[model samples]
Target: MADLLVRGGTVVDGTGAPPTPADVRIRGGVIVEVGPGLAPAGGAERVVEAGGAYVAPGFIEAHTHVDGAMWWNPDLDPLPAYGTTTVVFGNCGMSVAPLRESARGPVLDLFCFLEDLPLSAFQDKVPWTWERWPEYRRAVEGQAVSVNVAGFVGHLTLRTTVMGAEASWGRAATGEEIAEMAALLDESLTHGAIGLSTNVFDKDRYLKPVPTRLAEDAEFEALADVLARHPGATLQLITRFNEPDNIDADVERFARICKPRGIRAQWTAIPSTVREDYLREQTIALHRRLRADGVDFWPNVPHKPLEPFFNFERALTFQRVAAWNHWINGPAETKLATLADPQWRARAREDWDNRVSSSTSRLDRPESLILAISETGHGPLGISLKEYADREGLHISDALATWIGHNGILSCLRGIPDAFDEPVVAGLFAEPHTLTNINDSGAHLQLFCGSGENVYLLTRYVRDTGLLSVEQAVHNLTGKLAGFFGLGDRGVIAPGLAGDLVVFALDEIEVRPEEKRYDNPDGSWRFTRGPAGVRATIVRGVPTVLDAEPTGERPGTMVGLVSPPN
Candidate 1:
């Protein structure tokens, strides 16, 4: 007898297949069968009223920061609302595993640099039980999350274990240390870590020439060998270049590192930025080279709109803050004092007006500057430094300075000079070989307009801009992501997938920009958003979010590297 049944769902199987009207049956967490309709089999007791929902496979967020969120909040919101049943945590070479009481690792600093959330508030809420990867996995086993999650053994985490935080930055691991690291990685993989992750960028710090930078070509190759040991495993990396020729070399090196080990290595993003022509040609070349080397290498192109939010805690966007740390990462009074100091203010004005402008030519080009989330929610987002200054009736230069002083840490992304070609970015996501996912959901809690990535993505690109087909957009978010990570069973809706899904009212999904809310840490403002059209969301046959708020039914799992029984 089935444990539960869902009747009258429009199933858009994540296989890029068209929707089909059917009733899905579930038993013991797995979809037992699906067809037009059927009478109760024996004693199927419960039934879900899926009158108008489109039941597809739960979303697979390949890149996420829920490793910390889960430790802090069990019923993670926003994530479940996207129908994300399984999220791939420990992305970007950072992990909460292999942590030891004595292991002071550079990744720890990296993690601190990443999130400024006051998760310590929940210290009395959850027990800090596990010290290893497997134990942590077990600890989360029965927790009721709106979705399932898979853990990965991060590369920086590997380094952190072998060499404590201080040593990891400058010194390369000795041969014995490397072997020890390898053993630890193998153990983690066996314990259910899905794959490996490493990043080339540290949104905050300027990485110097260090061991992570100078890892012997052989070290990464060895890591790839470890990945090869798991045939279905995947790799997520953020490289330095997407230029055609340079990207080719990068892909070549990565593929060569993975081919012998039979691992698939994918880059974090191939966004439509200033380097579009180079990125497209280079991407095509990368696929070609991977084919030749028999290496599974593909870049996960983000078709989503992006806006990284922040306040002074995570990434303090004001330049020269490094030279003035006490003014930023320090006490509030000190920060306010620094802002009020005439000497520093005069110096900053001097630096921006004279030195900063020297780099920009007189030519009228699309100026690059980080946009601020002034209006509070996602609606008044992307308001540029230029716009903000104009709105306040001041010169752009004066406004920029005052903005930095007044806003402190609550600014979004700083614009780096790059050419823009929206069409190229659209084409990239539109390609079948390329997929889109903005893996920033759990990370930028306060700084940017990044939390509601899916909202901006669906509304902006697909609906407003007409960049992609709704089917293609949904496919990228659902099927493409699952396949990349080797979670075959839950990617598509069929007779045997989990009944994880979402149903939005389409036109109602717009999000209005609002200021930081219920500031977690003494009102430490980062960024907050609310979407318009999300009607209902479900996870593993449970309604985790109804009308866009968390329902506290955590039906998630600590997913393993290998696929589960069909």
Candidate 2:
């Protein structure tokens, strides 16, 4: 690798300190110097002139699901352009390792269903050459990727591997099963896994709770005990954020399991939305109480609002609604037949009226649903579903069925997102124990574009609304996440640190509009956004993205937790 010099930029060292004018020099994928008036070494050197730009440590994607996607799409498109140099995957109990041949299909099925990922792509694209964590790590490290990758050992993967896939979902593990799971977790942590991630928040297309939900208190205790033995290992849980009533009990249970074991526990989030202020207050109070008691539990928060696109081809968004879930999980012929079936339509209306939660699915609110995409160009696009129903003199559910039937099933209905709450976001941004930037990028590819969502933190919060200063925003994106994940080597712009950095003028970057891309292995399409106009996104001294385009360079390596809090 050639030596590199980044010049003429205001350096924000990612320590929440004020920005200062400086130049950074790198050699052998490590920062060698940080000062102004730095000249290139006598050897070969590449220079990036970052005039009038902010130079900061490369942004870390704190939460993502690129574990399976990385196998086929190694470039991790648009992430490089958004200044993301590191990505953390294996989240929400969806890692793709430690599986037996019998568990492979079940593991992939659960991952695809819950994540809204294409099942065909996962079945065909990923090279499942390993059945253990160490082998999985070697397979990933051998691949050339655009960003550094770290991951956790998924609880679902572990359960399915030890206790047959069918039994894993049916009942709580036996004592022997729990012991086997603990042994596997210990082996994974000893190998390189950052920690363990489990889910209590999801149901599959069949409305069945995930296998992790079957885990008992003894199971959790066993896993926590294993994590306690490993220094710098953490425990991650995805709780029921949608069901606000159960959140307090979930937090208390998790604290009991991991807090006593002396392991840091990171949960999916603390609700922060304009529509859910009451629930947000409850969660905030819960977190405060945990802090007062000195519990090492950190809650994550998403900086972007929830904007989802619903489609029938393959989606879990309607799993909460019985009528829709049944129709969506059926075969193609069954789907078309049931959409026109009068009995089915009646049941759908009943489900819409009584079963669906307004906070989750927007099926009840046709007015806020836009007919965004048309797979067959059957006409009538870009109109709200309510308008279509009004013009056609049809019920809302009937109108939706007619639209999807007329246009191809691949057509999508886009929901208007909740309003972004500036004050709530600002408070969480400044909160010491809160983990920001929980963008589920890599998963839900067709549902929403998570690629450029991180740009909103810099664009909306810092530049537009002034909710956060640039220093604070950068620190939250870089240093804070690195520390939480125990990645001691990178996430800062200083000598001896890994050469991971981004450069761009704040005014030049904005979250780009989402567009469709037909790049899936099965010739299917997915939603993806374009660049955020970042001048450069360098990973380990190599410029993966330069001048807003990919450089076709793959310098990423398999990174692991270096110093996780005990």
Candidate 3:
């Protein structure tokens, strides 16, 4: 890498301290100096004028599901431009490694269902050459990407690898199988895995519990034991706050198992919207109890609301609604047939009416659902579903079906966002035992755009609302995340640290609107956005994105607690 000098900027330093005017110098991917009036070494250094910009450590995407997408979408577009330099993958109990040859199809199905990715995209794009976590890491290290990547070993992947493809879903693991899984997890952690991620709160499109939910207590104990041996490793538990029937028991189980073992744990997430006030209170109480009990646990609160766009072609958005679930997961021929069937419409209307009150889906509030994107320049593109229903003189369920028949099956629907409870949101951001910005970026590419939502913390919370200071926001995005993940080498603009930095004026950046991009390997389209107007995004002294455009440099490599960013 070339030696670079960034001059004429206010340094945030990623420590939550006040900004200071300084010059930062980098040599061979490491920060050599960070102070005022630093001069370039002879004429061999490249100078970047950071006039009127705040130079800060590059942002870290704390939780993501980019395990499968990283292979196909190596550039990780829109993130580098949004000032994100590091990404953690293999979240929500899904990783792309340690697979059995016979379980590949089943694993792909699970990933696609959970992440809302197309099965064809995974089949056509990912190389799938590695079977173990270490081998997966090696393969990833060889690839060129713009953002540094780390991941957790998935419990579902481990179960499927040891137990047969059929047995992993239907029964608890045998004692021998649990031992094999523990050994594999130990080996993964010994190599470079950040931790173990398991899910207990989700169901597939078929409304069946995910495979990780079938894991027994013995399996969890063994996994927690492995994490105990590996210092700084975390136990990420994915829980369902919306359908929180077993939430209390699930959290108690996680704490009871991991806390005694001295393993750090994090769950996704606490509710942040007014509609979920009850859930938010319940979660806060749970968090307080966990902390009182001397547990090292963090509840993840998303900085952005979960405003999802739905389409019939491929989406799990309607999984909670039984009739819609059948239509969504059915074959192409069955999709049109069911939509036109009177019996299906009746069932769908009944299901929409009888949906549980705790359901967060827009099905409960179809009036807030809009007919957003059209596939073929069709009429009635931008209207509420209720308005359309009124105009067509039909029930809401029948109206949606009729609209889809008139328009194409590929058209999309979107839900209007609810206002965030600002005080609660601010509290979550300020709390020490909370993880903010848990955007599931790189997953749910088709259903929603999670890529640039991190910028909302900077744009809305810091600048617009004044809920958080610039220093605090920068610290949460950088230093706090680094400390939590045990990444000691980066996330701060200090001497001897990696030169991963983002430089931009506060007024210059804004999260762009979502647009359709047809760049998938399978010739499919996905929702994407433009940059947030970052002047420069440097990864390890190399400019991955400069002046609002990608420099096409792939300086990022596998990042872990033990392995520094390469």
Candidate 4:
């Protein structure tokens, strides 16, 4: 007597195998059987006719900033609907655990700044009842969510819990402080953290470096030693490889810490642009070297374009320039004053010019910056800055500034950079060591939407371009990533595995246009989209999404590494 039976679907079993017509039987939240004509045994409590669809392992979102979003929106909408069954949170050195009473305000503020999360969302929605890592895990587990969650103990949280505001202000921890942090990390892993996550590149909202950025080499080695003690514990790093010469050095540092310890290290945002071909090649070569030396170093790369839509009010575009930090972090009056100042304008122009020539700029040409939305007709509503500037006989920067001054906070710009070269991106996907991820789903809520990237890869890359076969893409999203993260019981359509599955029509798949929704706490607006072609997403043998809609059933639970069977 199976709890559920999915029949007549082509099963892509998440092992890079060719699809085969099969019937899957689920009982007691795990797959009981997968073969032809299994439903003939005749006692399925519920049967889903998945004819003309592909039944595959549900997606595992490898990187997300949904640490706080889970507290506010337990359903974690748009994710489950897009076929994500599990998500790894607390990325880029941000998490909501291991808090001290004194460090509460600073940690929340840092989270709000680094992830672009609204402070009101946390203050109004979260209860802030827990402090230690175990308590925090229990609190989140108590919540009702539609997708499974596996979180890393954040390095910033550990540092702040041990050293308080001194760590928040970029002060390097003392030797004793490092020992305390390491001990806490060990305890966190023992309690149930998936791994340890740290960021060496990100800065807080106030333009100050994150706590992990201030850590010395010895501190990182100490933390790695703690990770080494716990088998299957991973080290997630946001490497400071933005500069050319530093790439090899950063990789070597991570490899040194992870190699001898037999720990896996995963780094973020390997570039997919033509301009960064050199960086990408160097990264691949370095990964090969590390792998040959018996180090497991995986570089996470994006399957979609690294573009974000933003408004002048909260423009992450300008945040890259140090001169624009005050404007972004300050109040309206301060931003207005800065915009009005000639000295500030000159400095901003210089900074923008310098960034444009650097490897970090998202925009290749000013004309590619499209005005996505606007309330004022100061400039052309949907035209590029170059067109508006040429029409008004002004510099592009001046034209943008004038429009923002009149439109105020209501204008939005779509910063779609021409950096993502299709051939280079496909090549990266085909690479053996690269992990297809980097969807900053819960973060950048107002700026852009990356939640549908998993489906986007399937529709655009596999179905349309034929760059990657369905088998390879499914493996990339499921079994490969699940194995990397040690979620052993999921990410495969096999007997005794957790029955997290998705059934979707291959020909009809599509990612809808981005829409603005006022769904967050305090009536703040965030960009979202509806998904198509996905018929149903089942978590733990229960359908969380049916026919592209939430079924209001939360069968998801906290998942971690499974102990080896004796």
Tell me model 1's lDDT, rounded to 2 decimals: 0.61
lDDT per residue (tens digit) for residues 196-225 in model 3: 999988887778888888988888999899
**Alpha-carbon error at 69 in model 2, in Å?**
1.2
lDDT of 2 by residue, 25-108 (tens): 999999989999897675677899998999999999988999978877899887898999999999998788788788988888
- Candidate 4 per-residue lDDT over residues 25-70, each given as its tens digit: 8888899899987744455557878899999999999988888788
If candidate 1 were superposed on the true structure by all CA atoms, what would the RMSD be?
5.0
Model 3 alpha-carbon miss at residue 559, Å: 1.1
Better of 1 and 3 by TM-score: 3
User: Residue 85 lDDT in model 3?
Assistant: 91
Tens-digit per-residue lDDT, 1-566, candidate 1: 12666667677667677777887776777677888885556564466555665656666776777776675556565566555667878776777776664552345555655554443432334455765777867877856566788877777777767777667766777777777777777777888887888765444344243235546676676677777787577787766553333555655667667777678767744545554555556665666566665666777655543433435543434333333433455565565466667686666555555432211221112134555444234323466666666688864545654665655545443443354465666666665566566556666566444445555556766778787655556677788777778776677666666666666544666655635556443444434555444545656666666665666677777767546455
As a whole number from 0 to 100, the lDDT of residue 252 in candidate 3 is: 85
C-alpha RMSD (angstroms) for model 4: 2.3
Which stretch of 10 consecutive residues in model 3 shows the poorest summed lDDT?
557-566
157: Cα error in model 2, Å: 0.7
Sort all candidates by lDDT, best to worst. Answer: 2, 3, 4, 1
